[model samples]
Target: MSVIEDALAALDLETKVKLLSGQDFWTLPAIPEIGLRSLVMSDGPIGLRGIGWRPDDPSIALPSPTALAATWDPELARTAGRALGQEARRKGVHVLLAPTVNLHRSPLGGRHFECYSEDPLLTGEIGAAYMAGVQDQGVGTTVKHFVANDSETDRFTVDVRVGERALRELYLAPFERIVGAGAWGVMAAYNGVNGSTMTEHADLQIGVLKREWGFDGVIVSDWTAARTTAPAANGGLDVVMPASGDPWGQALVAAVRSGEVPEEVIDDKVRRVLRLAARVGILDGAEPAVAESARPSTLDGAAVARKAATRSFVLARNEGGLLPLDPARLRTVAVSGALAADARVQGGGSALVQPAHVISPLDGLTAALAGEQTMAVGARPPRTRRWSTPPPSATPSAPTRAAGCRSPKVHSGPTSPVCSARPAGASSSVRRCPARTSAGWASRHPACHRPTSPSSRSPRVSRPPWAARTSWRSSASATSR
Candidate 1:
């Protein structure tokens, strides 16, 4: 038996049971007596959010999975994944909750940006490459939303009714590749698959993932996903995240004492978690990782983000071959739209990360053409629909700028190009715009208006203005011609 197995054999029933659930939100309780360290995890597919979950603690913001999928290059995906692993290491994170391989079943799916293509083949290939890269860096990667967690609508309770053929062909295909690639962990979805919640699905979690496919890694439940005790433990769930009160705790202990849950089940769960700890080099006798110094060195994250962003661009519908604009021939090209100066690097929700720097479409154009272009902040993306992650608490983190203010100022006279707007869907002062500095009010519009800073307690002002506006449409039109 391995060290983790040996340690598991010595643990009492209660200690083993405690190991099954998280000690608190975002961390597992460290079993100091056994020399097991608390393993830290962070939310991400595009990038790592780490524990602070604040904009001030910025992380590398790479292209979204959908953007990476558009590149149709597995090597590029692997490179991006390696960069993610490096970021996790810098942030002292043991596992990254990423490479969300769920398919794009519906356009209206709240998290389409977090996933790859709708096609299973593409999702599988890209996901497998990403998994390989992350594991290569000695940090564990969790391939998530196991089995039909495609949408966010009533995600906790909605039942996904899919046939076996469809499940294998579509929903499970990407996860299959990730498992086959030997991913260190898998996260069960909040929703139910067929009639049983995924956290308690014995056939898939145990019979298929562990028994048939040989996924020996830990299986962690999505936060609060485990709603019951005996079933989840018996179904092969190894960890309950966020350490809060959950389906597995005193209740699980009672079930085991009553013979509803076998001792072997508890042992198996503890063993798997211990296995994960060993793999990440956190178990006893393993050399502890060197803590990153204050201001850890960023291993060329900017270069990786740039390469991924540049390669992921697909020239769809270049009609009339109006090919790349020749800077030599163009005297003055007028670029319109606010997003031209402030690009939307990624989509909304938990996948969001505050990038160190974002090079806007206009930024690239201006640098290339030099004196050959004029930018006009004409139309913006539609604002009718809002894409936001639900706040975790009564108050959310203060907003930060996703892209710098690229809004050009034409102060020919008092009739300057200006319009007054407030924070989208706000009742008060988050409405006031700040001075013309980077990460200010211009995130939404290019108006030359200045107001006092909003209260710090307000939610983060991070909704990328380009998210709602047709910024890309305008950029493509201007550049191609």
Candidate 2:
């Protein structure tokens, strides 16, 4: 038997099932008897955010996935992937939960900025290249939100009703391409497709992804996505993530003993998990797919990020040839917008990372026009409710109340940030505001309250005092008149 097969043979039902569930927020438990080590994973489509979200261990943040897609260069995407792979090795990460290949199906999609493009072909090509580069550096990559996770509207419950033709041609195209390119892992999304939840969608996960496309890697659940022990196990979900509240572990062993789930199915999942561990070089007897000597030499992360950012620039209509402004002829330049000074270098949520530094447009232009005068205009953008760490004294069980706003009362969790608040008389039941508008927070709740000031149109919540301070570094150049 092969090394992976041998490892699988030695594991009992409970040990096998345990291996498929996360031991912590970012890792899987290791069994020393079988010569397997803990497998570590982290968030990344742009950069690796390792286990800790602390600033002291910052990552080399790259441009958003959308910006990388705009470059239209598969090679550049691969280079960016290499940088992330290098970062992964430095951070002791075995797999990168990245290269989110979900298509940009809607302009209003909450994660549009995190996606590559509206075009599936382009998304597929770039995704394939990015996945290849990461794996090339001996780090595994999960091509994610598998099969029709195109939007975030009611993500956890929304049933994405898509026809097979539209689904195949548009939504599933990129995933198919990446799988064909031999992706090492796939993350099952939170939503459902047609009527079945993705985590329990056996027909697609087993039938299409594993059978039809022949994906050899593990299919892990998006954190907390696997809701049922039997359904997910039977549905071909090879792994459930992040340990906390996961539906697997002892429940799966119980389900198998009860005949609701087959032991053979559990073995198949264990086999896949072992395969992944072997590829990442955690399994003792198996040779890693990429050796240390084969990896590309050390990369200058900032240089790679700068190149990708510059190449991604798409001047849609330079009718007056106003761009590439001649510095020699320019007397003064005016940079505008709150983003110009405080750049949102990357999209929010799991994709967020603390870069060592950021280059605000204002600083970049000011440096470029060394002698020329530059003026910053417009007020800093209103702070919308985003995930930020609470004060040190705050506990996950603590209740955060937003005064006057009819937002739902939110409780912080051990692994997640608390970014919501509730009004004085709002229902105590936990609920989130439906959505946020550019103008402000929008809600259908009758008791909804608007922000007091015009600038605070969005529901206002307290943020860490240090978050308000602006720190800028000089890098890249942007011109505006």
Candidate 3:
């Protein structure tokens, strides 16, 4: 096959054609279980997150973000970009879910590493360079967190409550610049702006992102992000990420059919997604299929992964002249903590990833120490002392687990039905992340269950008829009924 044809063959059949063909192609029942349209999607932004067939713990990589920024080397960022993009390509991924450029508002913010910087110039410059490299090889780049996704604290339902000036100058500036730079995709952040959910906010998604910026790209709702169909579409969200479940697609389809949302809005999204397929070479068949076999490690995403990992690793304390560890005679490296064993590469909530393989620092060190004997220890949560199995990996040792953020009540698992909410007449959502669920929102106020495929467009509420539910009246609303 010619390079284009070779690339084309790599793409799933769904992504290998235009709207008519692509839609039919995507909607076809090639797979018996679900909508395994010939083509499936992989994530983007920082990297491709691989999820296991049966769901696993959230695999979060250490902060490689600020590490790349510290270098201030556009080329290195580009290299990281290329490597990540290549990883997506090898995995048959049509869209890469990354290069999250939300302007860092505070250092304490958990996702600081995943995003670029606080300054628009630095963030935009590096982001633009990164996207160019990623897209050049046919894979698409999705610059994200839309506006103000900097902090993880109360992320889902909290509104940033920013003014027009703050929103325009800082939060949305980098996105605008990157859009101008030919970024093919943009992701809506979970945070709300001006008392509106980013996913369902029309003014920002359409007025600002599409019309003012003239971004002719696909706008995918961040995982499980869509709260309502009408505003979400009118606001310009195209392909909803992780497609099926949630307050997204199915709810959207229902809204359209019920006359709650206009048909044109639906077509607009379809066209954009289809157009994206063509641009990314998915339509031409250059895209790889989303299968285990697709991620063939030629140069081994290892070499590249290592470099990316290194860049992402912040040399926080060179205090005792540590690190750039001298394998020759470093004597013994004492490792501790839960992170030491399981290196969390991504975050919880949406952007969760499942890499093909994870080489924790402990894993790397053990291999390095194989020749030379080393002391080991394995205590619960580990001591600041030793390790028995070369230790897993090491986070800042300052408590990897967030002290406050509730381990959120989400409903996902084989036996668990996907849960969500919908408008009165709308179909229940396929999947709804509990983080986005409001305290006293709806009739069911139920977490969404994956709606029946030929996915239900009929709205369903969670409350069983007999349950007398009471509201946890908050300070936000001071009403007594």
Each prediction's TM-score versus the true structure: 0.76, 0.80, 0.61
Local distance difference test values of all predictions, in order: 0.70, 0.74, 0.53
lDDT of 2 by residue, 302-364 (tens): 999999999988887986787776665443343423345555677677788889998876667
Question: Cα deviation of 312 in candidate 1 (Å)?
Answer: 1.0
User: How well is each residue in 1-481 modelled by candidate 3, as lDDT tens digits?
Assistant: 4333343334432332222121221121122122223434454455565433123522223235656676676776676666666665665666666778886665456566667777887888788878876775567777887877766555655666666776677878888888998888888876676666677777888888788888877776665555454666667676554433334434555666678777666656655654565566544333432233443233344565566556655555686766566645443344433344455555433344455567665676666554322221212232322222223432222212222312222232211111121112322223222232222222233433323343211122233221121221122121100
Q: Write the per-residue lDDT of candidate 1 for residues 1-481, one digit (tens) a residue.
A: 6677678877888899888777766777788878899988887898988888676779988888998888899988888888888888878899988778988865556688889998889998998898877766778888988978886655666667777888788888899988998899999887677677788899999998999999998889877666667877888788986554466788889999999999888888888888888877788965323332422234587788789888988887887665586644443344423445556667756787777777776677666654423222322233432532211221112332222323323211111111222222322211222233222223445443334244211111222222232222222211110
RMSD of 3: 17.2
Q: Pick the candidate with the highest TM-score.
A: 2
Where in model 2 is the C-alpha error above 4 Å? 372-380, 387-481
Name the better of 1 and 2 by TM-score: 2
Runs in model 3 deviating more than 4 A are 1-39, 44-46, 50-63, 241-260, 284-300, 309-379, 382-481
lDDT of 2: 0.74
Candidate RMSDs in Å, in order, are 13.6, 14.8, 17.2
